[model samples]
Target: MSTTTAPASATVADAGYGSARRRDPVLIGLWISLVLVAVVWIAPFVFIVFTSLKTTGDVMTTGAFTPPATVHYQNYENAWARGDFSTTFTNSVIITFIKVPLGLFISAMAAYALARMRIIWGKLILLIILFGTMIPFQVMLAPIFTVVNSFGLIDTYPGIILPYLAFGVPYQVFILHGFFSVIPRELSEAARIDGASDITIFRRIFLPASIPVLAALLILDFVNTWNEFAMALVILQDAGMWTLPLGLMSFQGQFSNDYGQLNAAIVMTVLPATIVYLIFQRYFVSGLMSGAVKG
Candidate 1:
């Protein structure tokens, strides 16, 4: 006499149910913590956008916590004009467009050389570049300013751009070099055997394969260049030549106490960087980590 066994379907269902029942408390706590953290990060931006729509008087009297009685759509338009964002935005556009491609190409080439080429003292050169990243930009301000002034580049687009390019290169090289190292050397040898030069191999083979890392660099560098204030403020003395960040100081005046206007200007000022990040954010994350993990 033998006992009957449960059906396979029933056994599977019971196992699944048991497994599902054993949820980890730590994971649940982590998810809860993440939600709280997300809320904490997002709350200020929500407040800024809502507060930006309120009238200046409403901001002063009703307070930042209070919602606007009427949505002031004109605040943005007024802020745009008063902030001189039209000129400043053009300057930002010019700087970003010129510097991003230039910086990315230069960094990629340098990274490719350091990663693949058998150069004399290559490690020493890489060490120098890495060391550059560790030094504070503020610390170099004096020397950078002196060089810019001596070259008579101050208050010009190139003046701000040169410094940004110089600062940007080492970081981009560091990241791109990591990605380049993981690439198969066989590919370069194959291309070389096919009579491809170093530049052609880099342009055709390496550059195409390194899009993720490049995209990450572009997004990061764009944000850094856009929001950069201290250097721009120091280098750009002419109001007409100011970038958006520098132009934002116009919102603060001796007589005007318009928090709403200032907040609206801030919203406009941050909008481009926000849109860029949101659009490329996925690439930004994946590309940043692509170099870290190797097969």
Candidate 2:
């Protein structure tokens, strides 16, 4: 009887092992696919870095995939100097600094009111704001230009910053509205019971709790303002006011199509945002996940 029971247990164990073996192929295949996709995505970035480090002749002759015999560190220096990137970098930083904080503050405040207030036309107000997002930016460009020019804002920092704020507000409001809606009403009520004013309640309760959403918004707004070229190009006509993207374009033209210098300029332009994302990667992921879960 003992011998018979041992054989039956061995048979059960063999069946379980067989089942796991069958599933292993599928799991292995999925892992391989993910790795391949990552490699494909990373390949272009690697190529760009290599191109940025090559000499002009090497960049033109060796192709983007080929490694140069000696890495040319001077390409970066030349690109920075020739592009006048220092001034352009300052301009970009100034615009981003103003745009991000103002955009987030206004949007968050508006969203809070829309989400928490018991106004009769709350849905209609939200609808209008959401509708603004659907309007193509190109359609508003002419009107915006006319308005900015009329205000004597054209070719000025305020000119570009004003339009960016207007365009960015709708999306910012939309995102913050969603976040504000899901925050517990009890928290606000508790603050009110403690004799806190509306502003205090927002500052002490909502703002602290909404950090994940705010962090996500900050990253989004920064990247958008940093990479914005079209509005900057149209609004800032002076070379002195050019941002990094426009400055890089000017640098390319000045270099007589030097590929190494162009690539180097591109790398410089990309580096700040890349570093920012890397530094905040964990917070970004957390924010995104938190927003998704709450939504």
Candidate 3:
């Protein structure tokens, strides 16, 4: 048979056309939008890093975005001591660590009952939870404070932790219930057939399979409990019992603000949250993707 071949120029042109068509316009636009948004979002952090290195006077004289000619490592040291962060960081850590685990366990139990077991008014309870999430935390602040005060729990770890658990549980339960409901019923049914108790199945089957979900929630609850300020402000009046957020108030004096120390403190405050987010970033993203795929 006689051979017939296209010119190299025509082949190259055809390949280029195919490659251009493969780059979807919508996807390209989305990437551009995301890059622009990321730059805008990161601007504040960049400004803070720059400001933390500058002196209070320099902040006024120089622009917000300007880099410092002389870096101030002293700012971190001053902020650490003046802020009294040791006590506050310990208090915040204790509250967050204790509350996150307890909250997760409670939420998982509730979600399991709602998702897997039959119970009277379970759907109604779930509906209530769905609505409860929409209610602002500010709405419950007065009642929570009143109850904490009545119980003489002010300035105690339980006072703050209890409220955190109460507010955080509903959303955790909602997410867990959705994830649990999508899991195959046969797994639990078979475990039941083998004479396993509900708790056993929860521990052995459901929980083991829900690692990504649990890890994501763990990170989220930890961050929330750590960053919570309003409830802590209302509950913890004792300086020894204050959390990091409360400790930040020390930066603002009656006459002037310590911009250097304030920005440094802000950076310090972000460290733990950023570390946690980085640690669980894998599970967080996977868990969300799993839910999206399942749904």
Candidate 1 clash figure, as a count: 0
208-276 per-residue lDDT for model 2 (tens digits): 877877888788888889998888888898989999989987887888567777788899998888877
lDDT of 3 by residue, 186-207 (tens): 9999999999999999999999
Over 89-170, each residue of candidate 1 has an lDDT whose tens digit, in order, gives 9998999889989999999999999999999999999999988899889989989999999999999989999999899999
Q: Name model 3 segments beyond 4 Å from true.
A: 1-19, 22-28, 57-63, 254-256, 289-295
What is the lDDT, from 0 to 100, of the residue 235 in candidate 1?
95
- Per-residue lDDT value at 222 in model 3: 83
TM-scores, each model vs. reference: 0.91, 0.89, 0.87
RMSD of each: 2.6, 3.0, 3.2
Deviation from native of the Cα of residue 112 in model 2, angstroms: 1.0
**Position 107, candidate 1: lDDT:** 93
Candidate 3: TM-score? 0.87
